[model samples]
Target: PRAAAAEHADQLFAGLQDPALYRFIAEAPPTDVEALRARYTRLATRRSPDGRQAWLNWAIWSFAEEAYVGYVQATVEAGEADIAYVVFQDYWGRGYARKAVAEMMGLLREAHGVAGFRATVDTRNHRSRALLEALGFECVAIHADAEVIHGRSPTRPSIG
Candidate 1:
């Protein structure tokens, strides 16, 4: 399922606080902690009309602090799942996202009994595309105008 801009905004702001930090990859301006918290709480506790969760999201905190630097949002598709992620600006340019993604993939493979994972990257997002490729994902194709690069993760070798 697709998420609302407000929900994504709330999470993006909360994950990357400082004005200087928020400017890196976000499309919106920075937000104060209070506004960020309120919106986050609302979105976090929000339930669908059917009484089910709004959307599934997960976070990876920064060390022992409540502060977070990485998180993932996934949607179920054809009995499988597709994931997307964002890392804080302070942590950008580092290999943290790659490391975190690798760990998440391992956990998902075990817990979900999944055979593969997939991601779509903007053509201009070289860094993200590279990270995906480094994780064993191959570019499957480019969507119209090459705006999106679809890639898939390989299945782990089976053990005897």
Candidate 2:
């Protein structure tokens, strides 16, 4: 789905309760399914309240596994999309996050006129930083004791 929906609250909320998933981030799991439903209901709008930015969220469903792995999201403004994503702890090292994020960036550029992409990865998450680099994102700035902000243009470079 293009946006988080209340209907997926139960399934998604279950994956979110894994404490290991929050090891590098500050957010704790939602207290209950109802809270997740409420949050998703608001996110379903897919637009910031003031309308200056577009909120794009997609739930990841795996056919082979018959489960919801996680999600990818972006906030877009002025031709740049700020990206974020997650792949539940159990699905780690399977390349799901990389694939999902690449697809999201492609859709944003082709359908939404997004020319650039950006992300802030927690400094301690070395795998995430490496993944972004593999996606052609260059680290543009770093927040001390926090995240490293990176950016990438839509067009990847050709082989030399």
Candidate 3:
């Protein structure tokens, strides 16, 4: 399969559409599998159009659920990976997202020479902001869009 193949997109599409998940971000979920498949097709390249960034996406497979419960995505550029993740509505409050994000950061550093990290979250999404904070990310900037982007070394977070 591709970096984000249609098959995997098909499987995860429905679960990715829970209304609660869209509250903090723009763009509603795809109305159908075909839309998702087409989108994933573009995401498979692992690179941005300008060739300045690398796109990484991984499905989070849960042993307990015996299924893919979520995904971690990163946009790597200039030695920093702007990361994002989602662990579908039914699977929230579990440690799956935390574990996956941690592992993905580790991989980005060791495999891709990413020395710093960044993440943008809607300010209203306190849980997500806390999750990034818990992972040692510091709030570096808050934008007019009501979003915040974090910047810090992954291993040396000054959580206070």
CA RMSD for every model? 6.3, 2.8, 3.1
Which whole-number lDDT from 0 to 100 does residue 24 have in model 2? 74
Report the CA-based lDDT of candidate 1 relative to the real structure: 0.57
How many steric overlaps are in each model, in order? 0, 0, 0
Candidate 2 residue pairs in clash (backbone atoms < 3 Å): none
lDDT of 2 at 144: 71
Structural similarity to truth (TM-score) of each candidate: 0.61, 0.91, 0.89
Worst 10 residues of 2 by lDDT: 151-160
- lDDT digits (tens) for residues 4-76 of candidate 3: 5667886799798898888887778888998888877777788889999998888888889988888888899
Candidates, ranked, TM-score? 2, 3, 1
**Residue range 36-55, candidate 1, lDDT tens digits:** 55655555643434553333
lDDT for model 2: 0.83
lDDT of 2 at 16: 96
Model 3 residue pairs with clashes: none
Q: How high is the CA lDDT of each candidate model?
A: 0.57, 0.83, 0.80
Query: Which consecutive 10 residues in model 1 have the weakest lDDT in total?
Result: 151-160
For model 2, what is the error of residue 61's alpha carbon versus the real structure, in angstroms, after optimal superposition? 0.7
